[model samples]
Target chain A: EAGVAQSPRYKIIEKRQSVAFWCNPISGHATLYWYQQILGQGPKLLIQFQNNGVVDDSQLPKDRFSAERLKGVDSTLKIQPAKLEDSAVYLCASSLGSPLYGYTFGSGTRLTVV
Target chain B: GQQVMQIPQYQHVQEGEDFTTYCNSSTTLSNIQWYKQRPGGHPVFLIQLVKSGEVKKQKRLTFQFGEAKKNSSLHITATQTTDVGTYFCAGLKTGANNLFFGTGTRLTVIP
Candidate 1:
């Protein structure tokens, strides 16, 4: 079975610019998530969607970051007016559901905001 | 807000040596999942533990969940060059909807 897929493996942009990343989850998976990982740190959840509905996004910088999973299959995460601190890897992951099940991750998009 | 912390931010060992990483959660978890991410690669799921005190093994890797459901450990016996990567432990707190990932433990095995 194919794993989660992400686009534009690497990206570089100037601060204050906008950047977007796309994700295609595993077939039939019901949950999708976006996470940010700074160098040498674990992934920090940015948002989670279950069947097109947001499940959680408490850690997301709502003022600049937004995500959507329209129709529950593919997802997109966007950062507008990106800041220098947003120069981390953006990982997209999918799961069957809940913690009892493991998640499959996509090769993240490494964003560098100058 | 919850925090899951992993011990020994980094570990370097001989190819034949053993290594272990620990994870401690601020709150009880319903289940915990472990993943391994090789350099420049995405995280690959390793295992998940649900029952308190549960122990699971995969080849040379052994995973343990604490009796209190707030801690976990991953032990790799006779580490090999192929085992070099960052190991992460993520958990779903009893009432949370998303999994909280711990600071990863980066492993380097000298061949």
Candidate 2:
């Protein structure tokens, strides 16, 4: 089966600019998640979606960041007015509906804010 | 909030040496999953452990879940250059819906 796919392997923007990332989860997977990984740190969950509905997004920065998983398939994560600290890797992962089941991660989009 | 902590931020071992990394959680975990990430690549899922005091093996890699479900370990036997990467333990805490990943242990195998 094809793995999870993410768009724009790399991105560069200035502080206050906006950036968006897209993800296509593995076929037949019912859960999709977005995570942010800062240098030297583990990936932190930003949001999780079960099918087309959001399961958790408590860590998401609602003031500037938003994500949507439309049609229970593809997803998009956006950050507006990016800050220098926002420069990090944005990872997308998918699982087959059980926490006990491991997730498949995408290549991730590396964001660098100047 | 649930958090997973890992020890030995980095480890350098001679080829053929054995290595191990530990993961501890501040709260009980419903399950734990392991992943490996190359220097420039994304994390790849390795395995998952759910039962208390469970031990699973994959070739030279051994994974263990503590009896309390709050700790875990990953041990590699006869390390090789192919095993050089960051190993992470992600735990799903009870009552929480998201997985919390540990800081990760970076492994280096020198020939």
Candidate 3:
């Protein structure tokens, strides 16, 4: 089976600019997650989707960060008016509904906010 | 709010020495998953523990889940240079559907 796929391996944008990263989870996965990892920190969950419905977004900064998993297959995370502190690696991962099956993560998009 | 923390933010060991990293969660966890992220790479799943006081091993590495299910540990014996990377523990809170990730422990094995 193919691993989760992410696009635009790297991105650079100025502060207050908008940027988006795309992700295609592993085929047949019913749960998708978006995580943001700072240079020296652990990956923080931004949003999660169970099929087409959202399961979690409590940590997402709604004002600046938004994510959607349409059709329950692919997802896109957008940061509007990106802040300097928002510069980090955006990772996407997917797994079966049960926690028994571990997640498969993508390469991730390294975003740099100047 | 849920939080998972790992101790020894960073550690350096000789190629043939032993190393260990610990993960603790604020709430009881139903299951725990471990991942390793090499420099310049994304995290890759290493193993998962679902039972209380469970102990699993792969090659020279050992994983243990506390009896309380709120803590876990990963031990590497005779560490090799190839074991260099950050280890993370993600815990699934009881009755919850999402995972709470740990701070991660970065290990450097000197050859």
Candidate 4:
């Protein structure tokens, strides 16, 4: 099986600019997650989708960050007016709806805000 | 909000020695999952423990879930350079769809 896929391995944007990262989770996965990982820290959940419907987004910065998993297959995370603090790796992962199955993560998009 | 923390933010050990990292959660967890991320790489699934006092082993790595269900630990025997990476413990609380990750423990093995 193919691993989770992400596009634009790297991105650079100026403060207040908008940027979007795309992710394609593993085939047949019913649950998708978006996470932000700062250097030297663990990945923080930004949003979660269960077959196209949001299951969790409590940690997402609604004013600046937004994510959608359309058709329950691929997901996109957008950050509007990106700030210096938003410069981090955006990761995407997917699972089969059961915690025991664990997760398969993507390569992630490394964003740098100037 | 639930929080997960890992001790010894970083650890350095000589090859052939043993290494251990601990993870604690602010609240009881339904299950605990571990992941390993190599330098410049994304996290990869390691193992998951759902029952209290559950212990699972893979090769030289051992994962344990505390009896209280609020803590976990990962132990590596005869560590090797290939074991270098950041170990993260993600806790899933009851009624939650996502797992809360810990601060992570970065391991460096000197050969």
Candidate 5:
């Protein structure tokens, strides 16, 4: 089976600049998630989507971060006015159902804010 | 707002030695899953434990879910260079669809 696919393997932008990341989950998976992982730390959930509807976004920084999984297939995460602290790896994961089935992550988009 | 914590943020072991990392949750978990993230790579699911006091083994790796359902552990026997990576435990709370991940533990195996 093909693994989750992510685009723009790496990105670099100055603080206050905006950036976006794209992700394509495994085929037939209905649940999608976006996480931020800082160096030496675990991935933190930023948002979760069950199909096209959002299941959770409690951890997302709504003011600066926003994500959408249109058509319940591909997802995109956008960060506006990026801060230096936002310089981390943005990971996208998917599961057949809930996370109980475990998750498969993509290569992730490494963002560097200068 | 549940949180999962991992002990021994980092561990260094000699090849052929044993290694273990612990994960604890602030509340009872309905299930727990483990993942391995290689250096410069994303996390890959390893296993899942549902029932309390459950134990599962894969090759030289052993996974245990605590009797209280709030803690878990991963044990590696005869650690190898290929075992080098960060191990994470994610716990899903009852009636919740989201999985809360632990801080993770990085392992370094010296040849």
Candidate 6:
């Protein structure tokens, strides 16, 4: 089986500029998650989707960050007016919807805000 | 808000040495999962422990969940250069679907 796929392995944007990262989870996976990992830190959950419907977004910066998993297959995370603090690796993961089953993560998109 | 924390943010060891990382949560967890993220790569799931006092082993790695479900540990026997990476433990709260990840422990193995 193929692993989760992400595009634009790297991105650089100026402060206040906008950027978007795309992800395609494994086939047949109904639960998708977006995480942000800063250098030397663990990945933080940004948002979660269960088959196109949001299951959680409590940690997402609503004023700047937004994500959507359309058709319950692929997901896109957008950062509007990117800030220096937003420079981090964005990871996407998918699971079988049961905690018993672990998640499969993508290679991630490394974003740099200047 | 829930948080998980890991001790010894970084560790260095020679090949064939033993290494261990610990994870703790403020509150009890329903389940805990461990992951390894190689340098320049994404996190890969290593194992999951759900029951209290549960211990699982894979190859030279052993994972343990506390009886109180608020602490966990990962022990590696005879570490190898390939074991160099960041180890993270994520805990899920009761009735919650989201996971809270701990500050990872970065391991460097010198061969």
Which candidate achieves the best DockQ against the true structure?
5
Error of 3 at A32 (Å): 0.6
Residue B80, model 5: lDDT of 100
Tens digit of lDDT per residue, candidate 1, span A20-92? 9999999998999999999999999999999899999988999999999989999999999999999999999
Best of the two (2, 6) by lDDT: 2
Fraction of native contacts, model 4: 0.84
lDDT (tens digit, per residue) of candidate 1 on B71-104: 9999999999999999999998888887889999
Evaluate residue A108 in candidate 4 and report its C-alpha lDDT on the 0 to 100 scale: 95
| Model 6 spans > 4 angstroms off | none
The alpha-carbon lDDT assigned to residue A68 of candidate 3 equals: 86
Which tens-of-lDDT digit does each residue in A49-101 have in candidate 3? Answer: 99989998988999998888878899999999899999999999999885569
lDDT by residue for model 4 over B12-96, one digit each (tens)? 9999999999999999999999999999999999999999999999999999999999999999999999999999999999987
- For candidate 6, what is the total of clashing residue pairs? 0
| Model 3 CA RMSD to the hidden true structure, in angstroms | 0.9
Per-chain TM-score (chain B), model 3: 0.98
User: How many Å off is the CA of B97 in candidate 1?
Assistant: 1.5
lDDT for residue A74 in candidate 5, whole number 0-100: 98
Q: What is the lDDT of residue B106 in candidate 6?
A: 94
Tell me which residue pairs clash in candidate 4: none
lDDT of 5 by residue, A3-67 (tens): 99998999999999999999999999999999999998899999999999999999999999999
Worst 10 contiguous positions by lDDT, candidate 3 chain B: B92-101
Candidate-wise lDDT, in order: 0.93, 0.95, 0.93, 0.94, 0.96, 0.94
**TM-scores of all candidate predictions against the true structure:** 0.98, 0.98, 0.98, 0.98, 0.99, 0.98
Worst 10 residues of 4 chain B by lDDT: B92-101
Chain B TM-score for all candidates, comma-separated? 0.98, 0.98, 0.98, 0.99, 0.99, 0.98
DockQ by candidate, in order: 0.86, 0.86, 0.80, 0.83, 0.93, 0.82
* TM-score preference between candidates 1 and 5, better one: 5
